[model samples]
Target chain A: MYSSVSKGFALLVLVLMNCIMFSAKAANGITVSTEINFSAQPQQCVTLHQGRDCFATILIQWQRPTSQTICLFHVNKKQATSKKQLMCWPESKAGQANIEFESSDNLTYQLRTQLDDRLLAETEIIVSWLHKNTRRRRWRLF
Target chain B: MFTKPINPNIINRLFIYSIVAIAFFIAATTHASPEEQSLTTHGNTPITKDAFEWQFMLDMALVNSPVMLTDVEQTELWDYVQLGLLFDISYKGFFLRTNSRRSSTILGGEELGYQITVQKDWQLDVILKAYIEGFDPIEILDDQNKDIPELVGLNNREYTSGIALRYSRYFENAIFYIDIASARASENEQGHSATGIIIDSFYSYLIPYRNWDIYLGAGLTYYEKALMDYYIGINADEVSSARPFHIADSTFRAQLEVYAQYPLSQSWSFNAGITQSFYSNSIKRSPIIDKNKLTQLMVGVLYVF
Candidate 1:
C-alpha cells in the first residue's frame, strides 16, 4: 500500500510538470494578457542576402473581452526611440490593421490601452536571410 | 596616349619582365598541383535552382578610328549594331558559356569557350578565337570613292580561326589572363602561307564609385613568323614594282584601354571606352601599314532581354 501511494504521488507530479511545459509552449508566440489578445499573420520575413532590406505586408489583429479605447504601435526594439502609433480604435472590442513594413531588422507591434498608456499585448515579426554577404563570383560580366 | 615612339631598349626590358612573370605563374601553379588533386576528390557543390540561364542583348556603338589599310592618313567615324547572345550552363564543376561579345576594355575581343578545370581562384579554358578580321580589296577606297592602287590587285585575306588554351586568375578587384594559341589563316586564292603560334596576356583592375564601374587594363600580344607574314607580306605571285615582295618577321604589340559603365536600370546600361595600340618595328615597316600606332574610341548602349 505504501509503495502504491508513492507511485501515485510521482505520477501526479509528472502530470503537473507536463501541464506547465505545455502552457509555456502555448505562450511562445503570444503575450499573457488579461485585457487583450494580439497576433500577426506572418511571423517572419526572409530576404535573399544578409543585411538586405526585407519588405512585407503584415496583418495585425487584436480582440478584448469588453469594449475599450486602444491604440496600435509599430516599434523597433533595436532603436529605443523608434515607436510610432499606427492606428487607434474608439471603444471597440476588436480591431485589425494592415501595415507595410520595410526593415533589415526584426520589429515589434504593441496593443495598449489608450486611457492610461498601459501595455496589454505584443507580437514580433522576425527577419531571416538565405546567403551571407560575402563577395559573389560573377561568371561573365567582367 | 603615346606622344613619342617607344624605344627598342624599353621594349626589350618589358618583354623580359613579362617572361619572368609568366615563369613565376607557371612555377606557382606547379607548386599547387598537389592541392588540386585533393580538391578534385571533394567534387563540386550541389547544384542550385538557378543553374541554367541565358540572355540576349542588342548592342549599338558609335566609333571613331584610324584606317590602317592604306598609306593615306585618315580617321573615319562609323556606327554599327550587333545582336549578341549569351548562354550559361553549369553542372557540377563544368561550365559552357558563349562569348558573342566581351567587354571592350578586355584584351581578347570575342571568343567561344568552355571551362576545363577550376581550382580555387584559378581556372583553365579552351576557346575558339579570331584576333584579326579580313578585308576585301574593294573595301579599301580613297577619299574619292575609288579603289586605291596599292590594294587593287591584292587578294582578300579571309578571317582565320584559332584554338587557344587560356589560364586565368580572379581576385576581388582585379583579374589576369594568359592565352596561347595555334592559329591558321583561312584558305583563299592569295596562296598565303599561314600557321603559327600567338601569345597574349592581359591584366585589368576595377575601380568602383557610386554605381559606376571603371576599368583600366594593359595587354601584350606576340605574333610569330607565319601569322605575321600572312597578313603583312606581299606574296611572290602578286609582287609588282610598286608592291615589292616583302617577308614579315615576328612582332609584338602593346595595348592600353580604359572603359566606364553606368547602369540606368536593371536591363539597360551605358558604356564608353578608348583603346590605343603600339606596333613593333617589323609590323610598322610593312608598306601597307601607314601608321605605327592605332587608336579607337567607342560609346554604346546595351539592352538585355
Candidate 2:
C-alpha cells in the first residue's frame, strides 16, 4: 500500500511539470507581426503636368514572421477600384516580401494583409497631382 | 488751472467699456464661417462641390530654436518652443473656407491663433491670420548654489501678422495647391525681431470616404539668423549656464511632411503628420544640440468658420 501511494504521488508530480512546460511553450507560440512600407521608386514626389500622363511605380514591402504565408490586396481608395492580389510565402532566408503597382491617377490606396483567412494589418498611401486645376470641373445645376 | 482731475467713476466706466469691446471682438472673430476658418488654419487645399468637403485634425509638437548663444565654443543654448492644438475646417471649391483651433501648452508657453481663407476658383485665394504667443524661458541649474538661471530673456510675448496668396488646380480625386506667405513677428522689448517667408507646395488626394484627405509635400523657409535661432535652437550650447544670452548665425531650413486630415463635421476635423527637417550642417553640428534629431510629430485640429 505504501509503495502504491508513493508511485501515485510521483506520477502526479511528473504530469504537473509537463503541463507547466507545455503551457509555457504554448503561451509564446506563433505571434505574427506585419509591417507595410510604401515606396515610390525612382521618384520621391510625382509631378503631374497639366493634361499629361504622370506615371509612377509604387513598391510595397510586407514583412512577416518567419515561415508564414501572407496574402496582399490593394485597392484605390479614391476610385474604389482594385489594383492586384498577391499571395506570398516568406521563408526564414527570405524574410521580406514585395509587390508593385503602376498608377497615373491621383488617388489614395489601401493595402490589406491576411494570413490563413485571418486579418493581419492594413495601411494607406496617398498619391497627389502636381499642377493646380489639372482635371477639376465646375458643378453645373441641371 | 485748465485740466480738471479725472473722476474715479468715469475711469471705471471707461475700463469696463473697453473690456466689453475687446470681449465682443474676440467672440466675433472666433465664430467664423466653416469655409473661411479652414483655409486660414491649415493653409489652403482644393475645395469640392459635394457640400461635405472638410478636414479635422489634432497635433502635438516639440520645437527647439537656438536664437541666442553668446559663446560659440561652449555648448550653451537657448530658445525652445512646443505646441499642441485641435483644428477643424471646411471648403467648397473656391467660394468659401474657414479654420479654427483650440491650443494647449507643452514646452514653451500657451497660444491661441486663427485664420480665414477665401478663394475664387483657380484664380485667387486670400488669407488673413491673427495670433498671440506667451512664453516662459527654460531655466538651467547651477551646480554650487542650487540656483537656477533663466535661459530666455525678458520679452516673452509674441504677436503675429500673416498673409498668404494661393493658386489651385484639380485632378481626378486630388487638388493641388501652391502658396506664398509672409509672417511678421512682434516681440517684446527683450525678444528678438523676426520676419519669415514661407513657400508651401502641397498636393492633397480626397479619399472615397467622406471628408478624408491625405497630403504630402516639402517647404523651403528663409529666415534671419535671429529668427531661426530663436525658433530652431541653432546655437543653444554657446549660452552660459549662469547667464541667459547667446548669439546665433542666420540659418535656412527645408523640411518634408506627410499628413492626413479627416473631417468629423462641417466645423471640426483632425490632422496629424510626421515632419523631418534637413538641417544645415552648421546647425546640425552645433555643440548646443544635444541629440541632433530632426524628426517631429505634428498633430492639431481644423476649425472651420
- Say which candidate scores most in DockQ: 1
Residue pair clashes in candidate 1: none
**For model 1 chain B, the run of ten residues with the poorest summed lDDT:** B1-10
For all candidates in order, the CA lDDT equals 0.59, 0.37
Q: What is the DockQ score of candidate 2, to 2 decimals?
A: 0.02
TM-score against native, each model: 0.57, 0.37
Model 2: per-residue lDDT, tens digit, B1-305?
A: 00001112223433543354345344544653333222332554543321222222233333222222222111222111222232222223222221211222111111112213224344445544432232333222121123223333422334444566656665666656655667666664564557665444445454432224555555544445544445434233425554334454555556656666554432345656675555455653433333322555545553433
Docking class of 2: incorrect
Q: Per-residue lDDT for B132-246 in model 1, tens only?
A: 5455554444332554566668766755567899887888777788789998876777566488888978777877644456778788888888887787778877676567788
Count clashes in each candidate, considering only residues at least 3 apart in sequence or on different chains. 0, 64
Q: Please state the interface RMSD for every predicted structure, separated by commas.
A: 19.0, 23.7
Query: What does candidate 1's lDDT look like per residue over A81-141, in tens digits?
Result: 9988988999999998888877778787888888998888776676654323322222122
